[model samples]
Target: MDNNLEFKTIIKRSFLDNSKRQLIINSDYIQFEDKDLATDYFTKFLSSEIKDYRYGVRWIRGAKFTIGRDYQIFIRNNENKIIKINFKSFYGINKSLHFKNYSGILNSLLKFYFNKIASDFIEKFQNQLEFSICNVHFSDKNIMIETNSIIKKKQNTILWKDVRTKDYRTYFAIYSQENPANINQCYNYKDDWNTAILNTVIRTILKNKE
Candidate 1:
């Protein structure tokens, strides 16, 4: 895919804030309470943004769910031509994958799903083109993708701001097919649909908590 075109597609999708769910450009994570909520979040998001696309294209991926919350993986492929894969999941209480056993369990899950997404994309694209991952994690607390590099950075740099909410607390991770570079790349556009969906989900979660 053309870098500029991919950037544009992401930017366009990111800037639409009226969307029920907010999209974090360069972020490879998402969180939701359950599959139904996750589906509703994405469906409402796409409905308000893309009129030509159908939400029913989503499928039941052959992956095991741990009984509580699982990320709903959505695949959009067209016979070795166009393939776009996305993932979304909700976070649960004490769902912290790491902080202690970061590498053994939490990181392992991250790496597994991340690689799963990449591998599936390769198969769908006939192992020809390089694809990216979009991950969303909806949690009140921040998640640390624990890494053990001594020369790593600590803080996150914000690139774009949400227009409606004007909040910049979200984090993003951008991965390439080959090299590892600056993952904190930010954008100027706001994904309205993502924000709306996220705001709705979070609000509901908080209400339930009360």
Candidate 2:
């Protein structure tokens, strides 16, 4: 196989389809071990650390597929948000994908696996997954109320987003991808590497002002 042509082909295939888009729901609903825990954690973060910032949380995945200690927070639209998420992931994917790392290939959507982490832990079991809430008002029946882009489906280069008038947010925690050896070959994890990946997504969203 011509390495150059193969690489290009891989890139094209991996690229999101421009037209085929759907709300790939990671789960129907988030379940918390204790409902109060969710409320408490939210209260603490919103009050102290994130008090000044606007509203955005970016959880960077470690090499092991776990949440890293160092997470990025955004209040107002800062340049750092964009720099850390999208661009980095694109670069990493370009390099790692060609290596035939199963993790890398399968990780295009790891929410499926990440959800598994919450299953065994009681503390985490109670926390909720990210959701895009939707509502319709009587005055404007035609207006869309809420939609979140937690899980996106795309066709080639085309992407479609759910447009309801509510906030789209997900509470994410990652685990390292090491122990789960079975999935490692395809999807490897590195500590702090995903900071760039998360930043890449943020930057992409920012560029489009979404």
Candidate 3:
């Protein structure tokens, strides 16, 4: 465990409010609950319970409010009840420093994910098993996608070597080797869950391509 990644800090709830929120991250889980003040009161979500996670630089409520890495995790227990804790941004005026905090916490979550889940996916892919994330499906040799067109959607299979991925500010798109200028699949950063893992899995597999 990296000492730098484990730190807790309390930030004021709002501009004039005195209620403080303590944000902490460790190798096990990320804590966002402030027992008395936290609206969601999410104590924590362990790696096993987490179904999906997303973090990136994006707008929260509207255009004026921008939060870096919208830190959120989707989790469900054995009962299949879901829980999500929303992020609270810092006050305006020289608020950039808070991004470091977001990065640190997110990195810890990343470490937990990589150690617990990511390696499993990578190993499964290497073992030639089919798996799906979001709407895209991965096979031993190719990625199956539904290409979107003006007229209708069509299923397409592009080999691992021929597949290409594009990342925009708000969307992640996959392209085939056909160069048809059609999107094999497009996923919104907000709506699509676990995009970070999807992107990493693609890159790692492609890098070690045989």
Candidate 4:
């Protein structure tokens, strides 16, 4: 990869043959363009202009076949302009075709979003005593999550010692390590953009604790 790497990709803008877009990503900037319209989708942005960002990845496999390879992302720049990229391609024979550019795009995208920010978020937890994103809340010693209690709506407070994660190819779930037979809750990667970051933050913190 050079200073800037470009890839031809599809932007999920309805079911059409020309859902094409061009992505140019570098260390400090990104440019997404509508190849069909010859106009900008996410015109361009510097690192400082990024206000909020989230991404999700899904690679499902079984036996000797691949089921799905999907990548989804959204970024909101300082101007409040947002750009979305859903690279699942179409269904059937073309479903996983978008994966051809998945690795390269995600590697660069992770560097763009995670570099230093991971440490920054960890630091925030250290300073403020908590961290929250995408409606998931974490504390210094436990994770507070929503539970399915039909009687009264409440959150399930799972201690760090009991918090166990399970990666189910297309989703992630947390369960009590003491009783792993029942999953507490699951977050589907395709639906939750920040699932990757949440996984990183939790894993990193767990490693430090260990």
Candidate 5:
């Protein structure tokens, strides 16, 4: 990836073939004993915290709620305890896609909406348990790359090569370490968000260089 490349151009090319771009939030090891109580708790939380945030809640199954104009949240359960919360937001190509500081804009978007939601949930349950939070920007596109050719030299990203298809290749993922957080603070900040993403991209490219 070129540092000088415009972010919109990268997005445009990444989705040129109608690929999907997603913002994903994963809350790991959430510890809530009662499922009903957990659902009831979040229902009230969403109703109160997101009333003015312009999000509508659509209940899907038990403890699963889709909020916001373009996002969904669901509580993952294990042995009757709520284990994790998964949140996702999708984006399509639109007028706001073009911006000079795309990284900055994304940072603000995540902090203003996604992070805020996750932070609220963490704070609400901080006394019950401590957990790890991870945010990911996932891009799916059609490409041709050799998986065997890739040397596993990087820790931040990975590429997947499809053997069944001649053309439907994909880069499997890019991710960072889990960000530790507590009631009063989270490790992720807007100041280093862009840098973290850029470094991940650079590391991915360097690892896959021909």
Candidate 6:
């Protein structure tokens, strides 16, 4: 079977007195032929690994689980034809009074965290069945620069000093055919960031058709 997959990251930021940020990372859509096996494997995997990495899992009413409060995973059976699983993670930063260099730092942290999770998934399922990861993309960073504070109509409002938004788009295709060689090399990297980048690059290559 030909491989086609994609994942995306969406980032939103507010640059006001109360600076805030939110990030959403989504995995490539996956479909499993054996619903029972897929559910069991993922459930066990999350139960053992989620908490170890500062994430909590909540069993949401039947066959649905929530990860880290904002992230959610659930299974849906479509008339017994196929079973669909959706997984997503959300991270947010609240506004703080103290000035801190958080935008770049938090962005890197979020990327690292997302890559870690992806690596874990690959490690677990690479040998079991066919899977692909590709189309690496990040939404345009939305930033608002606070110009000045003013009282308007008896209300306080901050004027936008500057606003900018743009998308970061890249394409790469990876497939299970190049498994252990490509993936193992990435795992062998001593630096975490290097490992993440290599893994992502290899996956993108495999997903791409020459």
Best by lDDT: 4
Q: Distance from true position, residue 87, model 2, in Å?
A: 20
- Per-model lDDT: 0.27, 0.24, 0.65, 0.66, 0.27, 0.27
Q: TM-score of each candidate?
A: 0.19, 0.16, 0.75, 0.71, 0.20, 0.21
For TM-score, candidate 2 versus 3, the one ahead is 3
The true-structure Cα RMSD of candidate 5 reads 18.9
Candidate 1 wrong stretches, greater than 4 Å: 1-98, 126-132, 135-210
lDDT of 6 by residue, 38-147 (tens): 34422112111221111112223323543222221222222222222222222223323111222332233334344565665445343433332221221122111112
User: C-alpha displacement of 152 in model 1, angstroms?
Assistant: 34
Whole-model alpha-carbon lDDT for candidate 2:
0.24
Candidate 3: where is the Cα deviation over 4 Å?
1-7, 11-13, 34-42, 60-92, 150-153
The candidate that achieves the highest TM-score relative to the unseen native structure: 3
Q: Which stretches of model 4 miss by more than 4 angstroms?
A: 1-15, 35-42, 49-71, 77-81, 87-97, 178-183
What is the per-residue lDDT of model 5 for residues 53-80, given as tens digits with 9 covering 90 to 100? 1111222333455322222122322222
lDDT of 1 by residue, 1-109 (tens): 3432111111111122323333321123222221235335331121112211111112234357432322222322223221122322233333353122212322332
Candidate 3's TM-score reads: 0.75
Error of 1 at 40 (Å): 24
Q: What are the runs in model 2 whose C-alpha is more than 4 Å off?
A: 1-56, 77-139, 145-210
RMSD of each: 20.8, 22.1, 4.0, 5.2, 18.9, 21.5
Kindly give the stretch of ten consecutive residues in candidate 2 with the minimal lDDT sum: 132-141
Report the lDDT of model 5 for residue 188.
Answer: 24
Better model by TM-score: candidate 4 vs candidate 6: 4
In angstroms, give how far residue 11 of model 2 lies from its true place.
40
Residue-by-residue lDDT tens digits, candidate 3, 1-210: 457657565555445556666666666666655456435644675656665665555445656655332444444443555544334454444356556655665566676554456677889998989898776788988988887667988888888778888888767778876764764677775567777677778777887884
